[model samples]
Target: MEAYVTIVAVAPFFLRLLKLLTIVLTSALLALPVYAASSPEQTLGLIRHTFRSHRPPPPFVRYTLTRRQLTNEGFPDFIWTYTYHIWCRTSDNAALGRRVFRGGSYGSLEFLRPTFNAATDPGPPTADLFEPAPATKQATPAPIFDRLREIGGVEALGETDYQVLSAVTEGELIHVRLLPRREPERNRLRELFADRRTYELKKAVATDRLFTQFQSYPELYTLTLGAAGGYPVVTAIHGVVDDSTFDEAARYIDYTFTEISFPATMPDWYFEPSGYGAHAKEAPQ
Candidate 1:
């Protein structure tokens, strides 16, 4: 009986020691810092450097724009999200342009377009033609760029002033910027692009699983410029789904960024200080 009693007392002490050792081992494993994972900024910097390193001769310049989705959380009813972004270009032949990164967020389950409030005369016939009307003094038509200009930080670049810079990689995106007007006229044009395609996230499961937990998916587009100051710009459009997964999002992002184009005639609707496709034809340097 004494021997059994002693064994029972020792067992508790041994178990305590085992638990102590286990905790020490776990801490040691965690303490060894894993290889420094590249930050989004570092990844972006590497892309700019890589583009310059490969081009012929010294004194060459490059530029890159990174748009990323910073926050994406899936909820039972909806997905809440936001993006932070940055743009960097070469300043001199060898000097890299300082990166300008900004962060912002947006919510979209159902977005409503702001009502058009006409303020003044529609003005002379513009790029998109309008028919003549009787001169009755109603409020004039709002300037085409009015709404766009309202959003801050739009820079106007003159045509021929900037050229295509370089082609950046797919991984540089870490921040995202919300482009004004979620439903633009360009969306209609996108429907016509022969290259444009859609993917259906179809999963065949056992009949028991009828409750399809849906999450929103993003569509990506990458535009690479051919000239000196030009850089790649990524755009994404997203919607909710009843049966989609993160893997589907990865595929959509890959395909979308791979194919987009610059229009032949710059639309006034996308003019500078408001739109992403800046450097319109009218503005002079």
Candidate 2:
């Protein structure tokens, strides 16, 4: 009888020990980097692939962005949602947005057309249309740049600006952590994440001055891409936004691309804006 009781007690202790060991082992595996062979070529290649733009990426996309403005008390106070149509190019990007609501608190916001592309617009402006190419080197548009930053398009950052701190495979996706080579780059772009096989950018997080150029603030960006028309188009974005022109408190924003399409044709006001391709009505058609 005494041996039976002792056996039961010892069995429970062993089971508890086994459970503790399992947790530790699982955590250790997560902490360690998965290696295939002598070199990490696969991981390195994936990083480089996502940094650069590839062919077949759609030039136009339309998405609904939801901004949940949070208070210092950790409560979502103001929620702003808008549907935006953006045309992206190497040198130009344009977007037009209208207010949408989840509950009923839609505020007054006029979205200017997006015209800055982080992948290339960070450099000097393109040549003038009416004048000679060298005669006019136009200044970079500040608002366009802000739109790019707000939307989590930080791929324009050069490779030399950052170093791959660590990379781990989580299921089929590759999660990479990056650090700035210099302290200055941190103020511009702090982090980036991308996919390997399709060469689609996943996330671009940064802390930089934007919009009205007040001061730099933290931004966490999550991005998603989908295949459309046999090409890649940004499907979604989850981010935190706060800058000089924005609310005092940081806001959690989500950009969901409901429709991704290219303009079949242009209209009479084709020469109105430099980056805009089609009007709001003609975009989805």
Candidate 3:
């Protein structure tokens, strides 16, 4: 063991490579006029088609995740931050290949860099990295949050579990809201408000009767979608989390996400723990 050390968060360097893509997407989305379809069914069909037309979500990605913590009184601060060298698709056995965690605010952040000397050090690969514990759990979500799950095409909406409440096209955005048909799902709400031009999911609001809920309040997730690459990555995820998930110190909290590239593939080492040293040194630049 090389007496493991903490890793440092990567700057949003990849974004630069992509050419300030977020700004471009924002500008494009705002200018593009959303043509409201005649009917909800037709609108849903168009959304599915539009998304499918794109290259598609890449198989591998890397980015920084910043989490902002807020008080019930509305005071906010940066509480937790993470830099994932490589985050695999949800279908992968491991959620993240290598990452660094810091706990604190901007000036006083407890950042740890991967300071291993790759050449001289060959053993005890960086510790405390990776997510999902490299274990696979195939637990199916209970038959609870059911109503509608758009798979393949629009007709699947008839009797899935979740039902579509409304699919409206407003000027430059498409807002599709969903609700559960059963008891537990009553307090729950699901919606997808996406940009018209790229059909990228920009706003998602829901009550995770399933997500942690020590206490509940009115909230919606305002996400920032970058319309580049085959399948644009959700560069930002802004939303609130309840007390239970927030460590019970606050009434409610707001959070967000910003990631980088979603390339079709990367080298095999990127997905392996030992391969971290090779890329770890590359993020800081």
Error of 3 at 56 (Å): 4.1
lDDT of each: 0.24, 0.42, 0.42
- What tens digits encode model 3's per-residue C-alpha lDDT throughout 145-251? 11234567543423233466788768767898666555422323366677776565555554431132253443344445554344544445445544343444443
The lDDT of model 3 is 0.42
Off by over 4 Å in 3: 1-38, 71-161, 182-189, 195-200, 209-220, 242-259, 263-265, 274-285
RMSD (Å) of each candidate, 1 decimal: 23.3, 12.5, 20.4
How well is each residue in 1-285 modelled by candidate 1, as lDDT tens digits?
A: 999999998999999999999999998776442322134233223222333333332222122222222222322211212221111111111111122323332221111111101121111101111111223322223222211112256422221211222212223222211121233312111110100011100110000011113522232322221222232222222222223544334232110122222223333332123432243343221
Q: How many residue pairs clash in all the candidates, one count each?
A: 20, 4, 15
Error of 1 at 230 (Å): 26
Q: Runs in model 1 with CA error above 4 Å? A: 36-268, 271-285
Candidate 2 yields a Cα-based lDDT of 0.42
